[model samples]
Target: MKEATEGRLRLTILGGFLGSGKTTWLRHHLHERAFGRVHVIVNEAAAAPVDDALLSAADRLTLLAGACVCCTGQSDFLRVLLGLCDDRSGLADPSMRVENIVLETSGLADPAAILAMIQAHPVLVRQIVVVETIVIVDALNARTQMEQEVLCRQQIEAADRLILTKTDLAAPKDLARLGATLRAIAPGATLSAARFGSPLGLKDPWSDDEPFALPEISEHDSSPINACQLDLGDTPDWTAFTVWLSALLYARGDQIVRVKGVVVTPAGRLLLQTVRRSVQSPEILPESATPVEGDNTIAVIGRGFSQDQLAASFNHFSA
Candidate 1:
């Protein structure tokens, strides 16, 4: 895995409004045949359990929150990242072996702040290469929010690729209205529709003739502080689990920018992780904290997520 840092990381930063289907879209992205080994940094504003469904994928997930990457992104980003760069840390995936990274920003994150931070981070600048920026817009609110919400506009205005999600929930004409507004904001970006199975060119932001520019330096992607860890006891009725998870999310959804953790259950241990919205599939890890190279431990990074609220949902244990 250390060898991966030496070449093209092809890192893509994912941005979107809350509940715009970013995580669901990413879950679908995991099965891609062309995708090499992937690493994710989940950032949210509050503490919430990771989507247990992802536990089936091989373990390679990290959580960062209670402090956001947008604000503390420089320190948290490098610390978690260095773990992957060092094969001794045991967080990097052993298979496929290419260290392709994806950073999922909070719903309220400004792409400009995120990019400038990454571009300037001393370790990251020397270690990784950013390939593109992808922003997802909620079809239901794009128009209204773009006109009224400062943060919403910033997210759209800074994207390299603008993806409209939840189109199916709106009328054809309404969807067009949303698209028109997004075009006005991110005129230089490739605008596409995203659904399960197909990425719909979200990764391919523009043509060779088009250019991907960086967001301004004045903006910051920081959010409030928060974190979460969910304990499912000794076992779980995994099929019926999404209910409490949904409740926990709604409790602090507005405050959450990222969430990540692993759940140990009788059904064989499974890992869990989530960015404020999008999540990566969890991989299996050894049950004990022997620090073996193959062990799985989940972590998240987000903005303004209260530690007290997160504590109610989950607990911290020895690694």
Candidate 2:
């Protein structure tokens, strides 16, 4: 790991599209102590954040939920960064000071915007040195995402290193094509593959594959993706909720990019997640893993729908 210059703290921006496995990769890296004496800042576009629970391995963890740090949450993000710098400066022992700060940006964030913000800020520019921007790509969905969402393309273009995730779930040919497509989007970025946060060698080299055709997506072409929180109340009917979620995705999967939350069930606190139309197997969190203030509420991310409509749909289904 390269040390920061002039006693500045290094910052690594971890960015990706919705459900691209950013948290999984960060969690593994933290467990491995990849960033020595690191402080992690996780920004979630949704008010109900579930990723923080999986990132307890960080030396210090701060959650900036309910907004995208690149935009809506810029003030809070800056405040947090400034606070970290202040705390470090106060430390008497130079060895005890934090070495690195890893910012896991919300999936919806444009890393370039965040970088520009940091670079433009006089204080942050002096105190923090952005080491790299590592963007995680969803191997199974990048082609489709790049075609539909302008933000996805921007994320790729801003990456210093692109980590293609969900490599195991994608077909070999598809993975190769996606890798090539990513390279084409950002020729300067180094590419690698990972599965469930573990590094994996690419089966087919991107150089040997053809890049997928990407359409020009205008910023106004699609409805803006937004996060809508649905309160499941204190006790949620797990089976019924699952059925309703399945039906909703079946009907509006294209409009609903991601669904995630932690709900208390008979078995345990189950962490539920869905990427597009595909539902991942629910993982039971450890007993010590506690949900934030907004537990039993799921954040549905995408566009073309309202929170009122989602709530009504769930209520009718459960009733």
Candidate 3:
């Protein structure tokens, strides 16, 4: 149990638009047997359970149907995660010492929303660290998808690594154009090309020392994206903040992609997160709070909201 509390669990989220080959890539990875003692969570299993079936040989894998982790299925996701914590001896699988977790989100899912939830869950923050966000882009259709689906653009924008899949099927000229477009959309992310299940010359991005880079929110109106950071200082009223957050999310669920923060409340340090309208229960921080210079800070990514709007809403939670 002590080891579970102290040990590190690295988490990697796989995201992409529909038909982007996320499952194929994951299936290949599993086949390679490179990921050791890792648990897998397949979201939106109802839409396509191929990934889940592919990993069914593993002793610790979960398939979540009828909901995406970013929204209706978040509570279930948290429960499954808590069960994976090695400290939960009663629930965790003794044969499998979980070292890493790979969450494959639905093609239509927004990775930002899932990332926010992971960052703001108390148990998760202490027991697991997100290593990277890998987004699969279909080289043949990425340009069209990016232009048509807001979720597609959001996925690309939030990725730490963008893997262009189906390259063999795409024309060389089209692939090149897609590459240029992705660079413009996700300038800070690492990009690579893959054909079939094999990543072409791409290296694994998760080493213990690798730095996690959160996605940057755009300030330009042309992008329909905005990122707001709120510094709530060292302490805040827990009840007030929760109330304000719930009301705000309820009112603007359609516009918000996600909200995640570490706040020092009067009760104790807590992790808070919301995806659209599903707000997860705040968990008490572990004995040691991850030091971040400032005690209480929150980051939000969304559309149709201005910084002023977010700040005003946050004002109600001010200590």
TM-score order of candidates, top first? 2, 1, 3
How far is 167's C-alpha from truth in model 1 (Å)? 0.6
Residue-level error in angstroms, candidate 2, position 301: 0.5
Models ranked on lDDT: 2, 3, 1
CA lDDT, every prediction?
0.57, 0.90, 0.68
Instruction: Kindly indicate the candidate among 1 and 3 with the higher TM-score.
Output: 1
Question: Which candidate would rank higher by lDDT, 1 or 3?
Answer: 3
Flag the better candidate by TM-score, 1 or 2: 2
Give TM per candidate.
0.60, 0.96, 0.58
Highest TM-score model number: 2
lDDT, candidate 3, 91-164, per-residue tens: 45655566778998976578888878977987678877777899998776666555545678899889999998
Which regions of candidate 2 are displaced past 4 Å? 1-4, 288-292
For candidate 2, which ten residues in a row score worst on lDDT?
286-295
Candidate number achieving the greatest lDDT relative to the actual structure: 2
The list of candidate 3 runs beyond 4 A from truth reads 1-6, 45-48, 57-59, 86-95, 201-319
RMSD of model 2 against the true structure: 1.7
Q: What's the alpha carbon RMSD for model 1?
A: 9.1
